[model samples]
Target: MMNKPYVIGIAGSSGSGKTFFLKSFLNHFKSDQVTLISQDDYYIPANTKTREENRLYNFDIPTSINRADFYKDIKQLFEGQTVFREEYTFNNPDLKPQMLEIKPAPILIVEGLFIFHYTEVNELLDYRIFLDADESVALDRRLRRDLIERGYDEEDVMYKWTNHVVPSYQEYLLPHKEECDLVIINNTDDPKVIDEAANKISVELHEKNSTLNII
Candidate 1:
């Protein structure tokens, strides 16, 4: 592992193509050179809370995550240490200890909604990217993903989108966009856009590494 790993933060409103951008970015390099840590996985497990009550929880809010632990893990990874990453089961509350073993790499990426909300996490980022998309486009994508992948119905998706997602974006996520190193408009399903962004990031990383080597 490299002594100093480069960390990238990809943040966006819910369903704004953060995951897609992350996947496309990862495709630019060898699998072993990059590591991914999703903020979605750092959600605190609802232990005694009933399923219905858990459904009412505003997961989009910063308080919904165990931020301290998440930051600790990220810091560990930055220091070239192995971390037991959490595997969040979106709609499934019964699964215990959603953890996975992850090794350190030269490039580390952490993506999610409210990723920049935590001060410590934000300070650790070498590059920050904010993905932007139309609210309607995001809603449509979120509805489809939740219905097919997360086992949510139309009503539940709409309810959460209207109540939790939009409000949280206005309050927590949107304000941080102005501070991002790059603001990518990702309204379309275009590979070229992703490639361009990833290439730019790769160049920035190469330059940083080269400077360190020269020193």
Candidate 2:
């Protein structure tokens, strides 16, 4: 019988550089050693009402995700089942979504803004990591991403940032941050900081996995 995969939950505010950190961390391991399941892909499709309402949908809220399905998929992974999901394109018509296949591995990483907010999902995490950043810096990063990658206007981005993102972050994410196993502050442009954090985490995870006889 195979040992259950060690599950890690990574949470942070939007534009907190979680993607950049994850990329650096993954470089230390082979493809088969770790598998990542992101909550971004589990967003519920926005209804016609939201589209007609000037696209003011609050995606930053926990209800925007299909939480039941996300939790079910994680349980399936723990049961040694492979799961497949469609990539979410942030309503970008220019980008085509791809079919994502997630295989069970020795280490499973669950990343998102609200992973810690969902009770069932939070309970499954063996380790939790919170990525911290200054509000101004995160907002700037968010603006660039929404403007360049998602093709959003400045007005819309600012509207969402002020009305949606900040509230949700304070209510859901920040409250549980103190309970996390690790906290990484990523407010700087220096790649060396991210590299050092990733290297330390990689070494620790390797040691833990070895002890569990799962690597």
Score residue 22 of candidate 1 by CA lDDT: 81
Question: Candidate 2: TM-score?
Answer: 0.95
Estimated TM-score per prediction? 0.88, 0.95
- For the record, the alpha-carbon RMSD of candidate 2 to the native fold, in angstroms, is 1.5
165 in model 1: Cα distance from truth in Å?
Answer: 0.2
* TM-score quality measure for candidate 1: 0.88
* Consecutive 10-residue window with the lowest summed lDDT within model 1: 206-215
Which 10 residues in a row give candidate 2 its minimum summed lDDT?
46-55
Positional deviation of residue 11's Cα in model 2 after best superposition, in angstroms: 0.6
Best by lDDT: 2
Question: Where does candidate 1 stray beyond 4 Å?
Answer: 47-51, 93-99, 207-215
Error of 2 at 80 (Å): 1.1
For candidate 2, give the lDDT of residue 129.
90
**Residue pairs of candidate 1 with colliding backbone atoms:** 87-98
| Model 2: how far residue 90 lies from native, Å | 0.4
